[model samples]
Target: MKRYQAVRGGTGDLTKPDVNTRVQDNLYLAVNSKWQKDAVIPADRTEIGVNTAIDMRIEKRMMSDLDKMVSDNKVPAIKNLDKAVTLYKIAKDFAKRNKDGAAPIQADLKKLDALKDFAALNQDANELDEVYGLPFGFEVEADMKNTKVHVLEFAGPGTFLPDTTSYKQEDASKLLAILQKQTVKLLTMAGMSEEKAEKYVAAGLKFDQKLAKVVKSTEEWSDYPATYNPYSLSDFLAKIKSFAMRDFLKELLPALPDKVIVMEPRFLDHFEKLINPDNFDEIKGWMVIKFINGLSSSLSQEFREAGFPFSQALSGQGELIPQERHAYYVANGVFDEVLGIYYGKKYFGEEAKADVTDMIKKMINVYEDRIQNNDWLSENTKKKAIVKLRALVLKIGYPEKEKKIYDLLQVDPAKSLYENEKALSKITTKYAIDKLTKPVDRSVWLMPGNMNNACYDPQRNDITFPAGILQAPFYDLHQSRGQNYGGIGATIAHEISHAFDNNGAKFDEFGNMKNWWTDADFKEFNKRTQAAIDIYDGLSYGPSKLNGKQVVAENIADLGGLTCAIQANKVDKGSMKELFENYARSWAQKQRPEAIKTEIAVDVHAPQPTRVNIPSQCQDEFYETFDVKPSDGMWLDPEKRVRIW
Candidate 1:
């Protein structure tokens, strides 16, 4: 143990400890403190830890390849590669952007200015989508109840504030002050006088504040059924009597659907009332602000500098990100799949994908055993659970065939960045419109392989582990089975467990919104889930308490994931001590105080410290491995432990 600790950087060993302040009450700190203390958060970043390190490693590799592409004199033959290279080169040309200034978005501003009244505004709104700064968000998504068909989804406008809860924070005034300053700066850069800019900024803020009032808290949106308000096109027109809903829909979606799903009807109702001619000036100003802000990063240095302080106010970032790194981000966003295909071919090998596939099968086997052995659930529910587990779709690494939807995408080097953005947006819209009438493609991946994240889609009954997350820290091909199982194995389990979590449990094996639970079984399940929520509800980070109900789905997954990993560990060669330590290492992270503040307001996942420690206390194996006595801070009464998997 001593030799391994020395060789592996001694994360879990507690015999000889380093102390800045004595908070070493649990295994998480004992395992992670030294590293966290020694680590430096970058000047441009709010926080830096395990996940950030892995993301930076991926970024470095991608940037290196992109730089090489830029320097190469040979003309690119592949259409997709050429498109990606063109976008990257455009992003890198800061001199052109500086010269163009706000001219690129001037046409958009002119459209807003030309609106004489609400009638003209509504006409423009119908033609404009969210990317074009429409007052409301509009999109087509598969209906949750009827997963086979897509429906138009309308919701309230997004707030500039990080979360709806931010409006109620003590720092709300300070944050808004920063927002106002930046808005004025951008408007002035767009050729408005200082006096006019201030007036516009005030009007925009008033408009946004009113919209924010009707916006549901992030917690409230968790109840899927609550947000699922479906109405016939005529019913919507009558309900929202203030507006020409039919005409708007006809213009926005030329082939208008008979039915539309209003995610939050109350918000829509308020928006309908707020959009009267009386609110024209404020509404127009707000639209202009939204348009310019969206293009701020792609515009001049003045806009970028103006936006930086507001960003710092939100996330505690001290410096702006380097221009090259910003270009990489833009390039990835513009040509995700093209870059993803290249990234997968260059870095993600077939051997690694196969290894992950094998690991997934083993993890599923463990879940099958648990469901079969569960005494609380009925045989009927147990059978359904096992079926769901077996039927779960696993998408490792990247998609088999990268779609060539962007073949017709034309990015002109002579064009401004905002012009390119508008061009790209139109292409994406056409693609989405094309998909609206088609059957749901279960094989399609929602995220690219180069993004360092994994997710489970309950609508599709599938889990995806992107190639970016399949590498070191998360999974090390050269590391011990203990480490791999503890890291990526737990992540896979987290996603799989989501299929049975509070949210995922609502759907059946085929991704239909049908419950397979009997009344008695469902009652028992809710009791268990509520207990888990209670545990998290009592936990706090900084000045904000966790919205336990909001985060319950994720909390359930975290605990169930740890349980699944522990079972998988039994088949591998490692002590409970080594396994638990590796598990702790997987979640190792630190945050700026401000970042923690925002996370408490917005994030669905529990803070990282809570993620590492809470699940450990619930495990009997953890108590046994660490010899956690009743007096230990990590101790949880066996009866109090909430195990929901």
Candidate 2:
């Protein structure tokens, strides 16, 4: 349900397909075939599509504005934008960067190497968090059951590959080899001998193999709301072996918490063997590579070249994006909200926000009708669903004010880029720690206004529609109402539908995880959910097959959103043909094979072709719009269609 804000790999063929393709056979190809044939994917980009096109246009405009602001000494009066400009200057200053090649991270590398045993590592826990994301997973977030307060979240560190399942692939050895080669190159540049670097990377990988066996996979993580398994603070500490988690928690948090959430109980059940005296060397090696790998991008150009292989392997890009573009991305990542506000203030209109807000409400009204008429849900369940829909807080364009931490984050001109990044991380770490006792602040937006994306945060019970996504294909005042309905209208419904999606269904209207469905109604809902899964399971994607269960949440949302969009359009007698064509047109894309393989393996959403074609066929209006016959290749059985809102 998210549109990426980057030039990601996509769904169309790399080679040209027949432009004379019939709409009944493949609607996506028929509507967007010619455009796909002519469009050239940039050398640095793995794929090209409508979302990437919109993202490129927005990023270009923002980069140009940033340059002008810096050159003319005319930064806007927006809060903390001056800090962004300062960081932007730091990122763009390659002369200083080239001069200070690798020196900035050398000290940090020494610090990591200094940890020889459990005592030293345990003693340096706070610094470990401030510098590197710790070897074991640690996060402070608002508890799912109690959204008003924060809790300490613990889990095993993530595996090197996309998921633990990837480690089981036959080509796993080859992929691990590529990562090893790059890590060795990076460590050697960090003043280690080639032999030592290779040994360290190999040892690190061995540890990774062990860790992967204990951690959760992407599919398991998809059911995220069920991650809340709280234990009393003392009982939680008793589970760990040889790690002074109690003392570590005390050093970082405001006070000793009453409870902590353990995300993966199985991971902790094996925590003793993972981090002990006998395995110190292997653990240290893993730590060395992880720290250097995390901060290598902001290091010297040598480090960037050394580190490019793993990234290039994931995305089949010929070369990196230009340095200026990289600089903007890095700086913007740090000051996202500050620059988002600037973009929205200059480019977004108040009238458009009001109009889109009205559009969202109307779409919700249609969804409400569907819920009321739903056969599976009883009246009790429908009432709760309606309350949740009505309570969905809308973050239309951007927030009126920024988070307080931005005012406190200052860029030190004398420090290196890596050092400045570390400094910012420290400030943010302190900020999050300070919020442990404070009430959760839902006013802080999840995505920046300059991002070409939208999301539904189940924990906060809200949906965000950024100004950047309000462009040609998704939304615009000039587009006809029918076109908009096909584009952003379906998209709006898509995000709203997430409130009732697989994971979100566990949470109540106030964003607490509680069962609100009757036993039989929930059983019926699961049956429909399986129907959505059956629609996509075992389907062939390029060089891969789709996993129905892995993608069922998004597929369910897609069907529900498209269904709601179709019903809403019929109310106004909108052109069904126009809606269907634009819906396919919006998902038009061309993807590289390497990118497609990775996407199918890890990405939650189906390929763009699947998104457009599969969901469209399920809707009855689609058959009427294009005169789809039973003999057509794309014609699907009515019994296979699923609409679970």
Candidate 3:
């Protein structure tokens, strides 16, 4: 403790404590106040905090290596990695791109222009799905219930606002207005007259406004298990009156399956009206505008600059990312797995990987003990929970096997970036369609190793800690064990806790959606989950308030992760104070107000401060370490604190 005080904290990307602030009153503020003062939201970024700081570093290292590969025109024997280089050159060739302007997409744009009516749309649906990327929404994934075979899932097309709830707000009109202006400008840039562009924009807005009314709200979407509504193939096809749905499916899928999982039953309820003759003009316009906006970056620099304000308003990003960074990110998205493998091999260390794997085991062990002793659950439920805990696959660092899709990628250097992306989209679409009857490969990772994040996929019943997150603030070999545990240990525990969260609880040990809980225990569990919701509900952050129901699962995980980490610390002796401080510090963030509003509207996670303070207040160990008083700002009355693991 004296050594930490003597240092007065490190500089640049490290959280510096504010000595004047008392830990008893505000843990996040006390830890983040000085760092917040020093932190600047980069011109091209909407936020910069703990995660982004690490992300920027990782990006720098990865991009620098990639930059060298491009410069030297060299690549290792890594299979199909040269395709990424091919794409990088294509995307990075701005001189050719600027000269080509919007010429490459003109013929593609003409396809939308030629859509005269519903019949035309039906004929083109498969081609659009291939080239344009699922115009509405349809995905192939491992069945939530079956957990082995892949299933077809069709969902709603949300509006320009993205979040359906935003349409309810009076302030949403301002955002819509921004969209309207940008859409018109982009259309005009694509060689449409101002009058024609206005007509197109108006029609698109009309469709979007109605679509927003019918689509699910962000809160409703937060319930992962409820989305698994299966419809008989015949029954599903009958819902679509106009668009020759039968032929479209036959072309899109390798074989017409027995079922179609309707992800948005409500959206499907109004499907015919939304996609029919009366609304054909509006629907077509919506498709056109969305296609243009989505691929605007693949066009000239002028087109990208034209679409900036709407992006700026939505995320409060001050300026566009440089073309070099933009090119790298675009290429990176397509070849991330390949790059992730290379990145893990080059940047990630074997020692760190082994250490993190051990920490993950400690967290899982603690969870097993917690479940065995959980007062709320019956023994029957306890036994089932332990089975799931033990079965939870830990994918640390990177995957040993690469995805089969990479084997098929053949990027052509002669083609335009837009053309390459379009061709690749079709290839990706075919790969996904081919998976309908195939068994779910549980070994395949949901997240790549290069991302500075971690995830738990309930369907696969696995947790992945990518190599990108195994660094400072999250994990560092040089940092104190308390800091390491509080940083990545809590994160590991967070992913474990997700297995028992409101959504994950619906799935059983085998990753199948089934109720393993006794009726009474399930009820009690929900009561506690509701309590978790109530605490965060309507809590203010900037101009928006959190929807407790929307963020309940993550909040539960945050609390549970903290609880398990605290217990793990009890077994391994460490500074409880440093654990508490670093736990608070890990969530240190600075976000733009616009970004916060957007996050509140759609994201399942609560604001950063909420992640820190709420979980800290819920922990008894936090009180002991900080000497929190009833009078302290961070203090919560014992009864008001929530806990469930």
Per-residue lDDT of model 2, residues 1-46, tens digit only = 2221211112333234558766777777778888988888898888
Error of 1 at 467 (Å): 0.7
Compared with the true structure, model 3 gives a TM-score of: 0.96
**All candidates: TM-score:** 0.94, 0.96, 0.96
Q: Model 1: per-residue lDDT, tens digit, 1-645?
A: 112111111133222234531222466677777887787889887777788888898889988888887898442344477787888889889999998888888877766656688777666565555455666776887778878878788788778787788888888889989888888888788887889778777888889888888888778776665667888877766766545667766656748788878987888778666777888788877876777677789887778887677778888887898888898998889788777767777789988999999999999999999999998999999998999889899888888766657686778888887788788878877777666677777778877878889999988889999898998777978877878877898899999999988888988887877879999999999999999888878465555677789898888998888888888988775566767788887777777788888877778888776677777778888877767666455667788888888
Error of 1 at 580 (Å): 1.2
Top candidate on lDDT is 3
- 373-392: candidate 3 lDDT, tens digit per residue: 99989999999999999999
What C-alpha lDDT values do all the predictions have?
0.78, 0.83, 0.84
For candidate 1, give the lDDT of residue 624.
76
Model 2 backbone overlap count: 0
Backbone clash pairs in model 1 (N, Cα, C under 3 Å; residues 3+ apart or in different chains), count = 0
